[model samples]
Target: MKFKNRRAMLWHFLKGNKRFFVLSILFSGLVSLLDLINPKIIGFTVDSVIGTEETALSPYLESLILQIGGLPYLKQHIFSIALVVLFVAFLAALCRFLFRLFNSMAAEKLIKRMRDLLYEHIIYLPFSWHNQNQTGDIIQRCTSDVEVIKNFFAEHLTNLLRVVLLIVLAVYFMSGIHVGLTVLSAAFIPVIVGYSFLFHHRIGESFRKVDIMEGQLSAVAQENLTGVRVVRAFGREAYEKDRFEEMNQKYMNTWIHLMKLLSAFWASGDLIGGLQVMLVVAVGAVLTIRGAITTGEYIAFVSYNAMLTWPVRMLGRVISEMSKAGISIDRIAYILNSPVEEDPEEPVNAPLDQDICFDHVSFSYGGESPEVLKDISFTIKAGSTVGILGGTGSGKSTLMYLLDRLYNIEPDEGKITIGGVDIAQMDRRYLREHIGMVLQEPYLFSGTVADNIAITQESTEMAEVRAAAKIAALDEAIGKFGKGYETYVGERGVTLSGGQKQRVAIAQMLIRKPEIMIFDDSLSAVDAETDAKIRKALGERTDQATVILIAHRITTLMKADNIIVLDHGRIAESGTHEELLSRNGFYRRIYDLQSPEEA
Candidate 1:
């Protein structure tokens, strides 16, 4: 789950696509080598053809010149020399093109792999981890941070390699012309490199601050967009706008500070580079006048030194940009390093169609927090209906989450079981597949009504979808829409009323045909008539499945075979409706509150 460092993590991600980057580096080396040849040819032409200096080309090149009819033939046909220069230029351009192409291919593949892995890892992460992290912040890590890493490899890292190689080779070529001039030129490199390292160290913390501010800005925007409806309903649009603007301004200020630092670094580099150029030019002129180096050799040496100009400047830029990559990599690693939900070591697909037991189960959301559910014990017999009544914060939903294994209870706290088999030992995927829960605030994906209902199935079957909708008492509502079952539900089912969304969710679960179904206050949004109708339909269809209903409504739980009332974190009463009413306990108190007119 955790990587030792950035390099180890990068190597892990580079698994399938390293070959493409290898090819890119190879082509880039070819391009750098090819680029060195043109200056040599230009120098050779100037010295031999025009000035009558001895041909100083290497033996292999001299042999090629002989094949092309010797120095006298070249002097008469000087254009042939131009043709050779142009040929080298064309090959350099071709290699440059291939280098970029392969580099681009590698970058795209690397980003795709990163995205796929992040998405997969996120989905499998525990619910507790999700609760502890913010949605917008996580999104920023996945998107913006991932992009920074892509640029790191494709642009900065590769550029670093290419520039370093070019500088070394250029210096070597310059040394061949005049070792003294080469020494002077190479001396400036250490200064530039040392300055770049200093700048890199200083700017890294600045980039980190900027990146953190950007994530905060992204979170603010995401929060506003998601809760736009709440802002509109409360007439707080102006307040929300001000809030976003404040965050945006902070983000902008941080970025401006970073840019200012970068500008200073670049401007200083240019000044140093210019001074180096002046020294090289002044010294080379003296050497040429003294006849220590010929005019052609002086020009070629200058050309090679000129090549170092961009690469030297770029070396600083690349190193500074590389600092941003470290920040991004750590951000991504935070997500990847978080442990994912793992199955039990020896998991079993236990039969869930049996008595569901919560045995001495106690839970706290955090270690130091008060227990949400304390010493809780209950049972739902196989193929029977049960109801739970609780007030807000009575840990009603928490109980269902525990049964679903969304939050595992510590071994010392307690255990839950179905068919006398501990739920902890069951395969998570298999357990969840057999237990269908419809939550209070139903979330429907952006899809047709039929699609939402049939989401559990691989392929949508209209017949099954319609049947599920009928049981949830949603068929008539679907018929009212022009598109009926095909009607598009907007984001989070915003297009549907609260009751309608609940019905859709109920229908979605019904289509799955799970052995155990829990309705976690799901019917509270619907009217009593619709609620009664849904209960009747469920009674007729779900004869063989275990049902556990949690609700605040007395009428909702009145018809259950057994009802348990949770007060605070413990059970206050447990009995049938008639028996509980006769006892005048917690269930009786709730019934009286709801049916006051009857009372």
Candidate 2:
């Protein structure tokens, strides 16, 4: 649940693949060792076989050569030395292949694990977190930031280890020829590393800026696509285009600036590396002429020096790029660190038949914001219908949200209970499973009509889907479609009319047949006759369920057993229709406006 650092977090996801990762590093070291042997073979051939001089093989190497017929045999068949070099090259190539294969496999597995964890965490996170964060920014972090971390582990980290090992091994072999030249070659490494450290430290801030700008640009584009209809309705094509272009230009400029910084660092590294090589070559020529070292030794040392040059130079760039990964890791860590919604330690089960009570409950959206609901007390008895009438911002929806446990209420503020048990102590999933709600704005996935209707059920039964649709007054409209229940709804149900989408959502909740049903102004889009028919059908079908209806229409609630009127976060009036009409209160006024002929 808690990771000590970014590497710890990565390792957690890579637990099963750690063996492959270790093998890859070991193979990389093997490849470097095989490569280092080639120059030594070339030097030995030059000294003993090609030139008129005694062989200078180490004791172990000399014993091995004797087994293959000694110096005389090598001199007679010179191609044998070529064959030796080819054999070493072949092993080196094989090791390199295995190294890459293992690293790729580990990297891909890490990526899949990371993506799965991020998505699962996002869905389980508290609703308030989603309301606070931008969709595009979160998506970018889940995708782009995750990729950066993967590359860091699979490529950058591996390469860092490989380069360091190669440098250490090369220096060890070069020291066998002359310690002075090896020291000279290694002297520039610290300078390159130190300079690179400082440069990357400064460049990290720039990379963060570029990453944020990219997320912002992506958000603008995403918002535009999602609200394409609104944009066209307002005739704001040119406005949206200009806005996007401005963000695009800003994002481009930030990346260009980052590239400029990278170019300067690379150019500086190249200059230092070039000088180091020049010093090595100049000193080796002096040592050779003065008989301090042999021509063969001098040639092998320079070859080793050449091998180390690029890796040392690349070390600086790798360190710099690694800093970018740190920023990405921190970004990903933010999501992983956020607290998930927690269930009570001792959870209570929701009763199948019970009264739902809101006992002096009040709520706010937190952080010094004004309260949205205040001192709200109401009760819906078992197997009864209750109506809620309120204007916009009257907290009708917020009240239902509390009952569903979408948001929690503090002990000091109030409590809601079901069947004499506090709802807060109930398991959230268990509580919501028994309570069905149809929201004011319905969202449907891209699927067939039957698929949308039966989404809440574990298995789709065509009969039940059609039956629910009939109760919601949606079956006839669905039948008219070319494919009927099989027709695709498109993204967010863009293919369906507003009335049809609401009806489909109603059908979805109806299929569940929950103990408590809440309709938060779910019938506003349908015509009066269709609304009445659906209400009539719901009344006949859901007689045993506790139904709480929130509607602005007086006609919708006039026939309910009881109705409560809300105004400005408080209950303004509550009574049956005839009782409120006798009192001439807020409910009576609304009834008058809705039915002036009867009034």
lDDT of each: 0.89, 0.88
lDDT of 1 at 445: 88
Q: Which candidate leads the pack in TM-score? A: 1
Candidate 2's clash total is 0
- Considering summed lDDT, which 10 consecutive residues are worst modelled in model 2? 590-599
lDDT of 1 by residue, 1-599 (tens): 67999999999889899999999998998999999988888888888888888856679988988998988998999998889899999999999999999999999999999999999999999999999999877988888888888889888888888888898899888998999989999999979877987788787788778878776787788888888889899999999889889988888888888899888988988899888888889999999999888888888888888888878866776887787688889999999999998889998777888999999999999956788999999889999999999999998999999999999989999899999999999988899999999987888889888988898899867998999999999999999998899888977443999999999999999989899999999999999889989999999983589999999988887789999889888998898989999998877777877874532
User: Candidate 1: where are CA atoms >4 Å away?
Assistant: 1-5, 204-264, 492-494, 596-599
Per-residue C-alpha lDDT of model 2 across residues 432-544, encoded as one tens digit per residue:
89999998899988888888899878797899999999999999998899888988896744388888999999999999999999999998888888989999999888349
> Using alpha carbons, what is the TM-score of model 2?
0.93
The collision pairs in model 1 are none
Candidate 2's C-alpha runs over 4 A off are 3-8, 246-261, 323-326, 492-494, 595-599
